[model samples]
Target: IGSRFSADTFRIRDFFAMNRVNFTWIDIESDPQVDELLKQLQISEGDTPVVAFGNEWIRRNPTNRELAERLGILSTLKEEVYDLAIVGAGPAGLAAAVYGASEGLSTVVLDRKAPGGQAGTSSNIENYPGFPMGLSGRELAGRMTLQAQKFGAQLSTPREVVKLEFENGYPVLYLDHDKCVSAKCLLIATGASYRRLNAEGREQFEGVGVYYDATPIEAELCGGSLVVVVGGANSAGQATVFLAEHARKVLLLLRGDDWGKDMSRYLSRRIEQTKNIELLTNTEITRMTGNGHLETIEIRNNRTGETRMVETRAVFTFIGAVPHTEWLPEGIETDEKGFIKTGSTVMNSPLWTAQRRPHFLETSRSGVFAAGDVRAGSMKRVASAVGEGAMAVAFVHEYLKEM
Candidate 1:
């Protein structure tokens, strides 16, 4: 029938659902046409979320960008050389690609998952500049991706960078599945990821009912049902407001008593104003239980030694984020928390031995730059990341001159 155990399936569905892409979902077990279609496609039992395009069927789950490539909507990575290569598709990397290409540089952007990075997952982003009425994270990211592509920047998604190797002055980035791409200058803007709640049964019910964002898919499924949201950040606050429109009631759990401590003033006020969103301060989710999907959650009061259970099928976590810099080698300088160190900050390190000083946003390794949330001491905002991405391209030009 329908299965949510596979991560790839969830990713494809999430991408399509968030973008409001129209498609018919056929459950194999429930629908009679599945058996005949499966036979026609010659798909095995394990092959799920099989995509049928024209007279062919792709018997595997694919990311949004991968799906686009398969449908001929996105061009493949045909060129071998690029003036600048960006290793992420977030605001920072996308900005760099846009400016780099518009300025007549051959640019190639690679992302392991999809465009927009962490900021692309939000249901609403009100603080980003230029949009007075606010916009969904998906919409904002989509527009940025389009703009970058329109400027002649080529983007390849679901493409992971396995390692970085230097030859002469070129930074050659190796991709997964033994693929590789080389560029005169490189930028690391991989950004960060959400930290999952470490409660019991967390993995068992991950996609079934537990989630990291409050996208429209969850809102549609959890309608008239009780829902729980953990964390006090703006992302958490946004999810609460969005879920309030569909869920019968939303339980906003916070480890600390003051929600305003970690969240923005505007989001705090909006959460306070929403009647259906109930705030549960000094509480944390300790356990989760369900048959196949989440049915209830066990919570504990951090301040008081009291424990209780709450009935809910859906729980969204928007806690702290951890940078994605583990793939980087030791030569690249990083902070205690693994964020990249750049510019004058790298000059103090023993690894920096170049005659000239490092440029702003330039990493310890010459001709390399870090931007967005991946850089140490960076502002965690979409606008700031975009600015950094665009600025990094300028530094690339400067470094190319010296080479």
Candidate 2:
């Protein structure tokens, strides 16, 4: 009996194949009894890859190297605990790791997926300081990662925090499948996820054409192709301008009549002058059609009842972002939109406080703090996130001293 696989599994398998790893390739999707075996293994819905090493059940994408290390299949198991565990590898998380580790606080950074967070998907960031020539978001993230690692900060990518519990005044993080580690201080910097389109065939064309982040590698696939960018925000404008260089043509779709006022005036001016870019106001994508890849998109003019079809190869949507705090238990004191609330408030308020009134970055649960884009009133800029990350560490220091 074989196991089912997901698109991520296929990608991982391809990567291993290129490395010439000895392994049998099986497509459980072609097997009739695969579903029954999946149920027996307690696999839930969603396309996931499963591997069976004898009687042991391994689900999803697991590296052979990791399996070897875990099962004493390799020479040794890597140490996992650290003095400071920074969740989320975005600007704030990266900054915290770099600073925390350099200050001699054994630091470890972990992210559910790949590093870079939302900023990692950015095509280019022109506003971050110290880069007069401007830098790609991926490049910036890579540099930060390198700097942190260089200073002895251990970073674990593609790791998810299944559970976080405070044990004896220390934060204990549980990894996938019950692997646990305790830390002196914990920084919740998991960042946010991009809002997805609620249209049909959207999931089918995810990597084939639909992308949330407009990175350079993703843009490379759009060479000579027509690309559609969704949203009126700065991210959308930046992606539109970036894709214009590689794509044959770019369409900027905005549900509102005007572009977001928060976008830089310089970027708005550049968008207006870019002939390859077409600005569509008061319009939205109604539906997309393709066999396995995106071939055409149907857009609707909200003000007018007219609909239009554009043959595009790729779609980059930056409609908005939502906090990735679903794993957090209730009573965290988030706003209506789910952003974590910070700052001290009036006395005798319902909000939990460690030592003062309104708690600063402290969650509804005492001692737990939130920072960066996940926190309310965050500036949401790369520089701002970095600053907040370092600031959060200071608060953690204070919180520890009080404890």
Candidate 3:
């Protein structure tokens, strides 16, 4: 149980939701029985956001890594060397696992947090082929996870790769806890992260009032409260539409001239049809003010130079994304934006060591590949990520032949 304003509670909830863990949340502030329960457990209110495992035990304000360990989602490596090690659990990585493992390659997928990267947090994906109606991001991830596991692909969650090294010409991944795993072939699908909101006080209210994705957990918090959404992309358009279902009003602020230009046509139409959503073009948040939670926001029209204050308790941002390449080693060349350089680009890089040209999706470091949103020149679509992921496995087999 936890308070409504507890940032720790918000993070736990987000983690559980994104990881598809089924749990009940009891609001300590609103629930009357929480006091009696705390008394029975001999625990104080300050020790809230506690995770209880039935009546067996409870951890007070536990971290995500701790919870993941308790949940058995984090596993210890048993193999001395894996045939293929995928460094991400996103669409591309998961796809690779499914293909690699099924094709008899000893594959293991590791992710710092949970599976599903940025796309996994999406509320709904309508444009993806099949499931014409649509499917939730969590559902898509759950199915893929099940398929990968069924094909004997090992998935280790909450396992972050802190550093990379090459020992005996094989990539060795140094994890968060000084643990290391080596692989014959590696696929770097560490997808991108959403850019943070630049408005003042944005960091302060991150979990308190500001959010990144419009999942059901976040939408529940919107209940009758006015909320704000920022961005002009399809993700922003999706958030505005979803929030409109629970929020009293939704103010969508965009820095671009035309919202339809960046967002999907269907989502743009849905936003236009939604009565509660008000689109504010060429506008941006100037400041966010609140005592403990978000209370008000100051927005300005870039063209008009006029500013106004809007009362809101929540703001969701989906401006853009940056690749997760900071932990990557030097041999893997990257574009100006940090997305991994592959294919012909790797052949042109000075880091290329092999006499033969690098295979498609192969990085400058032979036997290492990149796919999904992290790859330079990627399509940045779910279907494309999946295809690239499967295609990368083909190159992995070719690389193995050379070995």
Candidate 3 on 311-370: residue-level lDDT in tens?
988989888889999998788899889999998987878899898999989998999999
Model 2 pairs whose backbones collide: 344-358, 345-358
Instruction: Point to the candidate with the largest lDDT.
Output: 3
List TM-scores for all candidates, in order: 0.91, 0.80, 0.98
Count backbone overlaps in model 2. Answer: 2
Model 1, range 28-80, lDDT digits (tens) per residue?
54677878877877776578876666566464665565676665544466547
Candidate 1 CA-lDDT value? 0.83
Model 3 Cα displacement at 335 (Å)? 1.3
> Model 2, residue 30: displacement in angstroms?
25
Stretches of candidate 2 off by over 4 Å are 1-81, 345-353
The deviation in Å at residue 148 for candidate 2 is: 1.7
Compute the lDDT of residue 289 as modeled in candidate 3. 93
RMSD (Å) of each candidate, 1 decimal:
2.8, 7.4, 1.1
In Å, residue 11's CA in model 1 sits off its true spot by 2.4
